[model samples]
Structure formats: C-alpha cells, structure tokens
Target: MAKRRKKRKFILRRVIVVACLLVVGFFFAIKVLDLFGEGNSKSEESVKEESVTKEGFIEKIAPYAQELGQAYGVKPSIILSQAILESDFGQSKLAKKYKNLFGVKAYGNAPKVSLDTKEFVDEKWITIKGEFRVYATWNESMDDHTKLFVEGVDWNPELYKEVFTSKDYKEAAKAVQDAGYATDPDYAEKLIHVIEQYHLDKYDS
Candidate 1:
C-alpha cells in the first residue's frame, strides 16, 4: 500500500510540472506577440513621420516655385518636380551645402563645386566628375533654374522655349527631355510620375 501511495505522488508531481511548463510557455508566446505588435506600430509611425517630412519640404518650396512660374511662364509642377528629383527632397549634400537644386553646371568665373555624377552615355551609364553651380540660397538656385528656361543656354538661345510655352506639364517635361536638360533617358517619365504622384499639377492652377 505504501508503494502504491508513493507511485501516486510521483504521477501527481509529474502532472503539476507539466501544467507549470504549459503555463510558462503560454505566457512566453503572449510576450513575443506583444513585442511584435509594438515593433509594427513603431515601424508604421516612422513611415508616417517620413511622409510628413517630405510633404513639409514640398510645401516650403511651393511658394517660390509658383511665383517663379507666374513670372517666367514655366510650369510650377516642372520646377518643383525637378527640385525634388535633383536634390532628393533637399537632402542631398550638394543641395544642402551649395544650394544647387537643379544640378546646374557652373560656367566661366561662376562659383562651383566638382562632384561625382553619373551620366547616361552611349546607351550605358557612366560615372563622371563634373562641376556644379553654387548658390547663396535655395531661392537663388530656383531663380537660376527659371532663368535656364527663360533665357536658355549660350549655344541655343531657344533651347528651352518649348518648355516654357508648353500647354501642360506633360508637354513641358517632354520639352525638357528633348532639350537635353538631363542625360537620363527616362527624365521626362520620371518628372511626369513625380508630378502625378504628388499632385504637383494643382499648383499650376
């Protein structure tokens, strides 16, 4: 009888240990799930913050772009889109330090900085060192960008005339591409995509 009692106690201890282990495992799973939920929430919040910052940058430049557009007959959407693309939303080292938003090259005695740039050449992309213009402020950079469309370049006095006289943003983007404003083959497409994605055409009104 005593042996049977001891056997019963041993089985009971085993049952209790198993129950405790199950409880601990259940709690651990819940803790892991909570941590994952928190991580997702934080990630979503970070995306939201990044979006807000981008929108803020756009708003900051909109006024100047619009004013320039009105004065020069250039599309505000084109100006804003180029700025966003060239400067990477005003975060590029060139834009931040030198204030050259359009990647405008320096000529003659103008202040400039030499930077590594990529150009599409002979159906392939290649890295090249080029000199870019330096500006005192973003406004100056924007003004010069407007002037490029208004006054054109030294080689072709009417190079960018179509860009300013375009009836819509799409035409202007195509004009810019045709005028060889950028070496990228998809330059016009990129401008159109950005203008549509951000609703930049609203500024043209």
Candidate 2:
C-alpha cells in the first residue's frame, strides 16, 4: 500500500510539471504576438507620417533626412542642406530637365535623357542624353539622395564618418570639406550658408 501511494504521488508531480510548462509556453506565445503587433503598428504609423505634407520645402524633406541619417549614420541636416543648395529646393534646371539632383553624369553609352549638351573633348557640343537617377516624385528624389550617400560603395565612409559624428551642422560640413569630398575650397562654407539660410538643421534633431 505504501509503494502504491508513492507511485500515485510521482504521477501527480509529473502531471503538475507538464501543466506548468504548458502555461509558461502559452504566456510566452502571447508576449511574442504582442511584440509583433506593436512593431506592425509602428511601421504603419511611419508610412502614414511620411505621406503627410507640411508647410515648407524643408519640412517636405524631413523624412528623407531621417532615413538618410539612419542609413549612413550621417546627420540628415547636412544632406538636406546640400540638396537645397544643389537643386535649389527642387527648382533647378537640371532637376526639372534630367532629374539629376546631384549633378551625376552618364558615361559609356548608358541610357540617358537628352538635355542641352556641352563639349567635353574639343568636339562640338552635341545634344547628349545625360544619365541621371530617375524618381517618380520629388520625395523619391530626396530619398534616393540620402540612399546614395549611405549605400554608395564608390564613396568612402571614412570621408564622412567624422562629420557624421558631430551633431552640429557647421562642424559636420567642415569635416566633410576637410575630408576632400568636394574639389571646391569653399564647399564647407557654401554648405553652412545654405543650412543657415534655410534653417535646414532643424530637421536633424
């Protein structure tokens, strides 16, 4: 009778252990589902926020700046300030004509859209289709510009790493110029000027 009692107790303990494990597993699954739901909600909110329009051109590019900053670890303000200067807030002739916001050129028979051409090798200026990054809208252009800096393997990250580390736009621009990203001696000065002129750094934070 004592042996039978012991066997019954052992069976009860095993059943309790199995029940505890099942309960723990159920709670863990619930927690995981809650986390996944929150993530989806946040992603949807981001997409909706990106589609909204704000008062100025600077506001319009804020989302792009953030995406670029996240991608390259560079301050978005610097990129936005440079874009404003380069494309005049998307009103430049090149932007309107060829969608070339960064002044990138086509080489070696790549497909291009012909804009007015200039002579390069002592030959007459021929109507040349300039190869440019194409986008469906200005927002896409801004997004692409950020991606170019962050993902472009052709450009060295070391050149902008110091600049990106600085939170101040002036420091960042100066670092960029000092690192030889552009040939112009006044590149930093010009970038700073544009940032201040348009209050572009407000988006960085």
Candidate 3:
C-alpha cells in the first residue's frame, strides 16, 4: 500500500512539472508571434511610404538639370550627376535636413545654419559658423543650385566666360572642374558617372 502511495505522489509531481512547462512555452510562443506581426506591419508601412513619394522626388528635381545646362553651359548630365553624387540622389542626411543640393557654403550675407560636423576646406577641417542656403522645398534647392553656377562668386567668371562661350554643357562641366570649383579629387569622374548612370544628358538637348 505504501509503495502505491509513493507512486501516486511521483505521478502528481510529474503532472505539475509538465503543466508549468506548457504555460511558459505558451507565453513565449505568443510573444514571438507578436514580434513577427509587428515586424511585418512596420515593413508594409515602409514599403507603402516609399512607393508613394519616391517617384515624385525624382520628378521634382528633373527640371533642374536642364536649367543648369542652359544657365551654366554645363551639361544637364553633369549637373544632374553631380547633384546625385553630392546629395545621394536627394536622400542624404544633409540634403534632407538643409535642402542644400549643391553642398554649397554661404559666403557673404547668407543666413547661417548650425552643422553637427565641420566641413573640410583648405586641406583642413574647420569648425565655424557657416552659411548654407535653406529652401522651402527640394525644387527650390535644385533651382538655387543652378543659379549658383550662373551667378555665384564661387566660380571664376573669366573661365566661365571663355569655356562656356560655345554654351555646351559637356565643355563647361569639364572647365568648371578644371578651374577648381571643388577640391574633390574625383569630382569630375563622379559627375560623369552620375550622368551616364541616369542618362541625364537627355535633359540638355
């Protein structure tokens, strides 16, 4: 009789252990399912957002290439390419935040904007209160970028006058790079890459 009693107690303990394990496993399974559901929902929302606005951003900036080609005698291809490289096709943190498509720094009475990091210049990085052109929209940023080449002090007037006399975008882009408008070693190459990749030259002619 005592042996039978002992056996019954052992069975009860095993049953209790199994019940506890099942409860823990059910909670874990629910938590995992919730995590997966949340992940899928967030991914779907991201895809929807991207689909809605990606093309619009591309369209809005497209006109600037032609304008730059006409005004600066720089190939629309080069202008478009350079903008893409500098701003990562308008997806860069700086471009998104400041609307500075050309990565231009304000020289004179322009309004100043604070930057989290210093910009490289004269072979050194310096921290200073710098001015950047702020715009109401991406289109405004692209418009200003074109105007800068046409009317800004950054480019040498004499070089532009001589090189762009033909009003050819290709020649003008090369001249601007040769004249040291930017210190980047691969600036010209990058512009060419962008132009070829996107066939941006179509906008010029």
Candidate 4:
C-alpha cells in the first residue's frame, strides 16, 4: 500500500510539472504573437507615411488631372494644387480608402465615409464629424469634382465660375478663394505656391 501511494504521488508530481509547463508555454506564445503584431503594425504605419509626397503625387496624378482639366476647361495645375491641399497629396483617409481626392461633402445617393474634419465655420476652426463623399475610383472622384463645378449642389452652383474661366493657375487659385473654396484666407497663395513649386502648370499645356 505504501509503494502504491508513492507511485501515485510521483504521477501527481509529473502531472503538476506538465501543467505548469503548458501554462508557461501559453503565456510565451501570447507574448510572441503580440511582439509580431506590434512590429507589423509599425511597419504598416511607416509605409503609409512614406507612400506619397508632392513630387511623387504630381507625377502620379498629373495625367488624370490634365485629362479632366482639359475636359472641363479647368487649369490642370490649379486643379492638382487644389487636390493636393484638399486631399493632402492623396494620403488622406478619404483619398486612400475611399478614392475621394476633392473632399466633397457627401450628398445624393452616393456612399459615404464619416470622418472628423476641420473646417473654418463662422470665422473659427471647428472639428466636426462629417460624411465625406466616396467614389469607386480616383477617376470617378475627379469626374465628380468637375461635375460639382458644372452643376453646383445645395452648397452653391457655379461656385468657381471665375476659377473655371481663369487664364492661369494664379488667377484660378485666386478665383477659387474669391468663391470661398476654403476659409484659410491664404488658400490662393498656398495653391499658387504648390502650382509653381511642382511646375504643375506644365500639365495645362
């Protein structure tokens, strides 16, 4: 009976050791997974941050901008510069995820992307959750931008007529500002800077 008891005690000890090992292994596995997940997340963020810049953006979207600008009589340089300012060189969430480059407000039967955005309202900047328009492709977004000018919605029709008829990028930018395209008050100056800095006017020709 004593021998049997000793045998049972030994088995119990073995079982306890095995259980402890499995517990340690499970915690270790979780730690490893967490490390891997964090590494992948950081790398993804870094890639996103480096994905687009003015130089790269100008080359990538200039063709589409030119085509759309030509179709609508809008200066491609001004269009592209406005696009850069509105969409942050197409790196914004609305641009990357929804392919919306112009930051048009959501309306009609179109789908939407709800995001917090800053707007100058009543002479003050306010952050509000806004439903931004979404498009299936970048071309569609450009097309929509052109349409917004051709046929204004509830906001304002022919809002940028002066911009549309402008002879040059600077004039176009000034017209957009005069039309209240942005509340920055220096919207035209900034756009002119962008147009000249990247030589976006070359696309107009």
Ranking by lDDT: 1, 4, 2, 3
Model 2, 36-68: lDDT tens digits are 999999999987764442125567666877877
Per-residue C-alpha lDDT of model 4 across residues 79-153, encoded as one tens digit per residue: 788789889888898999999998888876879989998888888889989899989998898888878777765
lDDT of 1 by residue, 167-194 (tens): 9999999999999999999999999999
Off by over 4 Å in 1: none
Residue 192 in model 3: lDDT = 67
- Poorest stretch of ten by lDDT in candidate 2: 117-126
Q: Highest lDDT: give the candidate number.
A: 1
lDDT of 1 at 40: 100
Candidate 3's TM-score reads 0.64
Cα error of candidate 2 at position 15, Å: 99
Residue 80 local lDDT, model 3: 66
TM-score of 4: 0.70
Superposed by TM-score, candidate 4 places the C-alpha of residue 4 at a distance from the truth, in angstroms, of 72
| Highest-scoring model, TM-score | 1
